[model samples]
Target: GATPSIDRFDPDLTIRGLLEIWRRNASLKD
Candidate 1:
């Protein structure tokens, strides 16, 4: 059996975090 791993600092995670941050900021500005 293989265990899945979570990478908090992965590039994908960072990109997603930035996207979410931008989305929230954009919503606040609207």
Candidate 2:
């Protein structure tokens, strides 16, 4: 996965990375 596991990264970083990926994918679909 593009994002690191929660065990590797802080919770905030993991969440931010996931959200970033989601935004990128959403943009691509537009």
Candidate 3:
């Protein structure tokens, strides 16, 4: 099922997603 566009605007989810990406990048830098 396609996720609703409104979910992208959620602050908590957005922050979590950004944190996940940042963690991945940080790990790769090590």
Best by lDDT: 2
Backbone clash pairs in model 3 (N, Cα, C under 3 Å; residues 3+ apart or in different chains), count: 0
lDDT of 2 by residue, 1-30 (tens): 743555787889878988999999999999
- Shift in Å, residue 25, candidate 3: 0.2
User: Which is superior by lDDT, 1 or 3?
Assistant: 3
- Candidate 3 residues 1-30, lDDT tens each? 346664757788888888999999999999
Ranking by TM-score: 2, 1, 3
Candidate 3: C-alpha lDDT: 0.83
Better of 1 and 3 by TM-score: 1
lDDT, candidate 1, at 16: 91
RMSD of each: 6.0, 3.4, 3.2
Candidate 1 lDDT by residue in tens digits, 1-30: 222444436778878978999999999999
Stretches off by above 4 angstroms in model 1 are: 1-8
TM-score, cand. 3: 0.68
In model 3, pairs of residues that clash are none
Measured against the true structure, the TM-scores of the candidates, in listed sequence, are 0.69, 0.73, 0.68
Better of 2 and 3 by lDDT: 2
Model 2, TM vs. native: 0.73
